[model samples]
Target: LLADDGGHPAVRTGADRLTLTPVAELGLGLGEGGAALTVLPLIQSALLLASAAGPATVYTVDSQDVLADPDTIRA
Candidate 1:
C-alpha cells in the first residue's frame, strides 16, 4: 500500500523504525515530461488492485465512486 504522510519532514525519522518498500519505477524513470504517461500506469495499478479485491471489499469501500467503478477503470 502507498502511504504519503503529506511530505512531513518529521515522519522521516519514524520511517526508519518501520519497514517500507520503495515504490518501483515500473519502467517509468524520472522525468520532467510525459506527465500523463506517468500517471496512467499508476492509475492502472490502483484499478487492478481494486478489481482483484472484488466489490464491496476495502478497496472498493475506501475508494471514491469513480475510482472503484469498473467501467471507469481502464486495464
Candidate 2:
C-alpha cells in the first residue's frame, strides 16, 4: 500500500490487493500543536485489525518517503 502526505493521488492497480488510506487529509490542527498524537495509536490499531481480517495489506508510508519518486525507490 502506498500512501502520501495529503493532496497527492494514490496509485492503485486492479491486480494489486492493497488498501492505502492517506490520513494526511485529516489535518494537524486538532489541538495545541497538534495534540491528536494521542489518538494516532488507536487509529493505527484499528487499521491493523481491519487489515488482518481482509485480503488487502495495509501499510504506512512516511511523509518524507512518500515525496520521493517511486522509480528511484525501485532502483
Candidate 3:
C-alpha cells in the first residue's frame, strides 16, 4: 500500500521491504497487481523519520531467559 510521505509516496509490500518513489515507478503495464498496490493507504511504524535524531539500541532475547529472570530483563 502507498501513502503520502512528506508529499512523496511510500509502500511496504513485504517484511523488511519498503520504497519511497514516484507514481510512474509502479510500472502498471507489468501486471494488475502493481496497479492495485497503489489503491490502499498504508501507515506503518517502519517508515523513516527525516527529523528524528539521537542514539538508539535494540536487544534480542530468548523467551526462556525472560521466564528465568524477569527482573534482570526489566533492568
Candidate 4:
C-alpha cells in the first residue's frame, strides 16, 4: 500500500511489542519523483508465537468471507 497510498505498515505481538518493516523501494517514484511498485502476502505462525515470547501465550485467528456475495464481503 505504501506504493499506492503513501502510508507505512507495522505489526504487533502478544507481548505488546510493535515492529516496523521498511518497505522496499519501487524503482522510480510517483512522477512527483522517481517511480515503481510491487505486491504483498503473509508471515508464518511459529515466528509470530516466538515474537510473542512463546506459543502458550499466542492466539491467532484468520477469517475470509465468501466472494459469492461481493457486497457482503465488501461490507
Candidate 5:
C-alpha cells in the first residue's frame, strides 16, 4: 500500500528514512520531479500476522453503512 502524510515532505520508517531529491538533467527520461513515495508498514504487519494464523480473508467496511446498523456487526 502507498500512503502520504499529506502534510509532511519527508518519508520515514522505523529502520530508515529517505529525502526526495531533484533530478539535475531535464527531459532525459527522468519521468517526474522530486517524487515522494511511501510504503505502508501495515502491509508487513498484516503479512506477519496472517502467516501465524492459518488463513484469512480481508474485508473493508464502509463507515456510513456500519453507522447505519452497528448492531449487526456486534451480533
Candidate 6:
C-alpha cells in the first residue's frame, strides 16, 4: 500500500498485498506493540485493519477492481 501523503489518488491493486502486524512480532518490543495504524472507512480497510476483537469487516476486491483507479481513490 502506497500513500502519497498529499492530495493525490491512492489506488490499490490485488496484484500484491501489503500487511502490517504488531511491532512486538518483530521481537523488538519487550512485551507487545503494534504499528498503531489508523485508516479511513473504505474497502481497503479490510487489508489494513482487522482483529478478532472488533466488528467484522469483510470485503474482497478483484485485481482489476482497484488497479490504478484514480477516481476511486480521488474520491
Index of the highest-lDDT prediction: 1
lDDT by candidate, in order shown: 0.49, 0.47, 0.41, 0.35, 0.41, 0.33
Ten-residue stretch with the least lDDT total in model 6: 3-12
**Across residues 1-75, which tens digit of lDDT does each residue of candidate 6 receive?**
322222112312321234422222222222221212222234245645664357755656555657857244321
Across 1-75, the per-residue lDDT of candidate 3 in tens digits comes to: 332222222333331265444333444443435444553432222233422644455666668887887654431
Q: What lDDT tens digits, residue by residue, belong to model 1 across residues 4-40? A: 3224445435654575422333333333333345556
Q: What tens digits encode model 4's per-residue C-alpha lDDT throughout 8-44? A: 1221232124233324444332444222223232224
Candidate that beats the other on TM-score, 1 or 6, i.e. the better one: 1
Instruction: At residue 74, give the lDDT of candidate 2.
Output: 25
Which residue pairs of candidate 5 clash? none
* Model 6 pairs in collision: none
Top model number, TM-score: 1
User: Taking the candidates one at a time, how many backbone clashes does each contain?
Assistant: 0, 0, 0, 4, 0, 0
Write out the backbone clash pairs for model 2.
none
List candidate 3 segments past 4 Å from native: 1-55
RMSD for all candidates, in order, please. 13.9, 17.2, 11.1, 16.8, 12.6, 16.1
lDDT of 2 at 29: 39
Instruction: List, residue by residue over 1-75, the lDDT tens digit for candidate 2.
Output: 222222323323421345554443454333342424545776789889998888755565566676775433322
Candidate 4 stretches greater than 4 Å from native: 4-22, 30-37, 41-56, 59-75
Error of 1 at 57 (Å): 6.5
